[model samples]
Target: MSEIATFAVGSLFPELIDKEADLNDWATEVERTLDLIPSVSRIEIDPPRGFMSFNLGDATEFKDLIQHAIPIGGEIRFHILIPARIQERIKGWSVSAGNSVEEFLVTIDLSTTYPCAFIIPLGEGVLRPSGAVIVVREFLTEELDKLGSKAAIKLTTLGPSPFHAEFHIKEGDVGEILAPGIRVSRAISSGYSRWTLHYDPEVHESAEAARTVIIQRLGYEFSTFYRIVAHRNIHRFGVAAIEAWVEGTLAFYGGKGLKSWIYRTAKLRKILHDISLEILKVQLGIEKVHKQNERLIEKARDRNSKLALEKELAEKAELGFRDELSSYAEMVGVLESRHSNTTQRLTSFAVSLLGVVVGALLTAALRK
Candidate 1:
């Protein structure tokens, strides 16, 4: 399993693209940019949908803008009210008021690199991420002009085409689907409509493969820095690694899956914060181990100093045979010289006493 990087490509693939080149291009970008990590939370798209006005409110207006953006894609409509009715006058029609909030919530799961997409034909979308609501509609409109088509939709992934899903109807009186890709015209049998697709499996596989590569990189990073505790520091490395991998993969596949990449990033930013804290603590412990090593070095230095002092004393006190013998010879010579001087003095004193005794004997004979 470790040997095969793209082992499971051909299996469980969906059809979407025709040409291998196009599929690969799309796949590589989508994979590299998105699906690297499993996000911890769900994403919510809150569009202001006014209620009780008998009218499609702010959310409907923005939905209209997105619809116009798509050249020939499918459409989106909120079935807020059915055919309306008026008072007893019977003059004209009036939309019956309903009690509902003015915002639409679209919940997205961040774990899969899968795609949840639709086209914005009419234009305005105020999409934002995090607790802060951003001016997403204006931001996308400007970018869409450069991209040529106003048609856009969200997807868990763009790789491996035919990545399909069903979303909840925000405010509807009837069931509807916002599908951008090809679907069959078969009528619902019993209660279900069969949507068919003619797609290339390789494109899906290639894109999935690219996503696998990016995810592997993320795993490597998460595991490698699992010990790092601080969220701020983790961002310094983690965010950059994610960005680099995403960019490289996209570039390799011809820059196709940029939209999915943005959506995925928006979803995962907080997950990184949570996991990073756990990892930061782990890394801090490792550093503490390194500090213990320094203490061991200190102990070793103290031991070496004591041994050095003992060695120095032994060298200073060592007795050399040649030098010791010479010192002994010098002491013996001085002792022998003093012995000869004492012998000469004793002999001179004895001779002088004998001379005095002979003179006394001569004086005694003269007296007799």
Candidate 2:
């Protein structure tokens, strides 16, 4: 039977420690450093959150090196999983270390034959464990070394104290030796064990390819969530919002139950349905407004075209009226000239008759 152990580490960076601390660059450095570890077979990086997951070939060898670093005004936590074969030679073991600022505990299940599982809960935060481990180890090794000494002494002493307990396991009751403050539903079964320490939930793909796809999806979804939330105009929540909530819940609980998963997914689906309806309404309203504007533009063009045609007809009518008045004036001038010639002829005829009468009267007087 193979054993599976899970560990989590957290770190807090001071606001002004490094003004130029780029998360992507920090992730790259962590990836490179973890690659040098002999047991690490694979290293996965979450750049936006500065999170990383390391798959080790033999986790037991580096067990002692799993130490926490303390920094002034900053906190760092480390979580690691080690799978070891159970043998008769070793009896039981527990290790713990803490100060005023930080605390940690590690315990092994002695009663279980093989395939035992353990969990370490780190508090809620956004910084990645890889970057936390690397940066804290480099910057605060002195503080970590002091804590490491206490852990070593505690492991060697093995005294009976509140922090340490011994238990006997019955045939079916594996929960007899559960560590303090650790709660789990079932025992870790014997098989090829897989461990994932990440900040996002991904779609189910092939077992080998799933982690990569999940990390990519997580980054995308996280970014989209922030973008949507920042915009005041967007009132509807969708898949991105749901993903953010689920991710936070999983991170806080450390991925515990099947029932919680079902509830969260169903809730997300219902919200998405409502948001879709809202989007459809917005689209329809926009289309209606566009149609109204188009009709108004067409009406204005038609009115302007009718006005232009009316103006042209009015100018043509004015020209026709002017030409008819000029023709009437020319006909009046010809009639006036003919009437003057007729009056002159009548006056000349009357004068000739008077002249003949006067001549006859003068001739009769001279003969008498």
Candidate 3:
């Protein structure tokens, strides 16, 4: 079983920052960087597709021979070929470093991609892939940091995996900042944990994206373990021990590795978790809406009850007013009847008095 570890450095720009004018310098820097790495027995620049050959000895030789070969403002890639003997040496070193591995192959790739460089160690049943990865990562980081600092160039996003971890640059030098550490670590850890629950070896063969994500997570863990070991300086076997422990734990937990285990178990867990959260949110929303509706119903009932009470009062007041008016009209009618009777009596009495006076006057006139 061949195992591979990768280290990548990206977004490196020359002080001049002009790809066209700085082509020569860039090539020189790339060559110099490659030279810093040990066990690089051969280097092939711009090999034919699917084939590799090396001829250049120095930057000038490569520049003169391949200047016309590369187009203007085009990208450059270097394929480093390490001999089997060198790989054996690395394997020996890894085993000496506490890994239970006797053989592995290491390959370094320098390209124009986001991860400009990839350090890959390939082997089978390699007990500690991460040990080899960390060694190379440290070496590459140190060399790149030194070179970048000297040239006043900034090397951003330098790491073994494409987890978006970056090296900050300040004052034309690489700063001690690992950008995207928190976010990338979280994503990688979550991915690895999910994969542990559901990983299938057959699925890994076909699922390139899934494999890449898982491998990147592994690389991230490797780097993190390296940092922790280097910081504490107390752990025995360091990265190798950590890698073995992590891999063993995953393999044990994965159990009877079915092809659909990862997809079935991890994905189902994620789905169920998501659904549970959504249900919780929905239930909360329902409760909120229910409470609001209850409040509205209570307000409506209160308003209706108030209106009913007011209506009842108005009806009672109306009846009372009507009764009072009827009573007052009846009293006035009785007074008018009494006044008419008195007036009739007085008129009859006055008429009788006038008749007596007229009769007495007529008698006096006859006697005269």
Candidate 4:
């Protein structure tokens, strides 16, 4: 809380400006100027990350668009912010838009002190966000068209970057962006709600483009953080409460049984308690039922594998046969062949002996 700054026009509710005092150092200046009540505050946690968009059609209408942009809840679209969020880039070379300059110090006045979003058309337009706009061959919107992701695919309808537009919001730097909504840092660095961010000015060497860059960044941050905040706010304040209240109002509206109405109120009370518990679980970062199921699955798998191995060993032991089945079959065939050979040899020997005796007797008769 002691280290952040907020928009100069925001409500007096808990804001980031109380922490910032006077900022001579640009790095600490945004934070220092937090004293400007209602100004945007310091970025709290995580190297910043989120979506960005630019929605000005072209440069010809810069003045009109800038006027519109100053008011809260104004319609802004089709501006380049980060990683291809815009469908079109304001034409850099076209006569309709001014030349896209690279690297310079810029200051567009959207100060709540003046209650205006006027681009300070001074000595030179403040253009540096670290450096002047890097006039690349293609605008972020046009380049993103070539990508296959849904974020890019949806922006194909956006024509081009606006000649007069917001700057890009980035992971670490904060400026040039404003808010009629809430902004939150990444969720990981959750505790101790205070932090600082920095960008290299010397390397960028273009301060004039600061407003456009910061405004673009605000587009990205707002798109990301505000959506989440809105959802949470709605759930916390709208859907959850409305659903509960509707049930109550309907039960009592026009008419109802006295006892039934009492029971309904009691039920509503219990539901609110339960809803609060669920919200608490989410806030506490304990809401992952899927992980709980995965843990159970892992435990079951471990138990099953152990059981399967044990069962296999038990089956092998139950048979308890020492001889291999194929070896025993081969032994049986060999014994049978040896027995057949021995029987054949004995029969042949007996026949041959009988022939010898017959021959001897014939010899004796001839001699006589």
Q: Choose the strongest candidate by TM-score.
A: 3
For each candidate, give its TM-score against the true structure: 0.14, 0.18, 0.26, 0.21
Error of 3 at 331 (Å): 80
Candidate 1 per-residue C-alpha lDDT over 1-368 given as tens digits, one digit per residue, 9 for 90 to 100? 01111110000111222223243233333233222212111222222221111121122332211111111111121111111221111121111222112122222212122112221111112111110001112222233344332222222112111111111111112222112211112233443223222112233243233333322322222211111111112222333333343344334323248785444334333433433443344345334534443343334334333221122223222212324333333433443344345445656776887778888999998999
Window of ten residues with lowest summed lDDT in model 2:
156-165
Stretches off by above 4 angstroms in model 2 are 1-19, 49-368
Off by over 4 Å in 1: 1-259, 306-368
Instruction: For residue 180, give model 3's deviation from the true position in Å.
Output: 33
Q: Write the per-residue lDDT of candidate 3 for residues 132-238, one digit (tens) a residue.
A: 44444333455456655344222322222332332111111122212212111111332211101122333343223333443343332232222222222211122
Poorly placed runs, candidate 4 (over 4 Å): 1-201, 214-218, 237-368
Model 2 agreement with the true structure over 1-368: per-residue lDDT tens digits: 11122232221121112224453354354444434433333445333332222222223243322122211111112233222221111122111111011222222221111101111312222122222222223323333234432322112111011111111111121222122222112322342122232221132222223322322222222222222212211211222233344345335333458875445433534443443453344344334434543343334335333221122223222212223223332333343343345345545665776777777788888888
> Please, what is the whole-model Cα lDDT of each candidate in the order they appear?
0.26, 0.28, 0.34, 0.28
Q: What is the lDDT of candidate 2?
A: 0.28
How displaced is residue 238 in candidate 2, in Å?
41
Sort every candidate by TM-score, greatest first: 3, 4, 2, 1
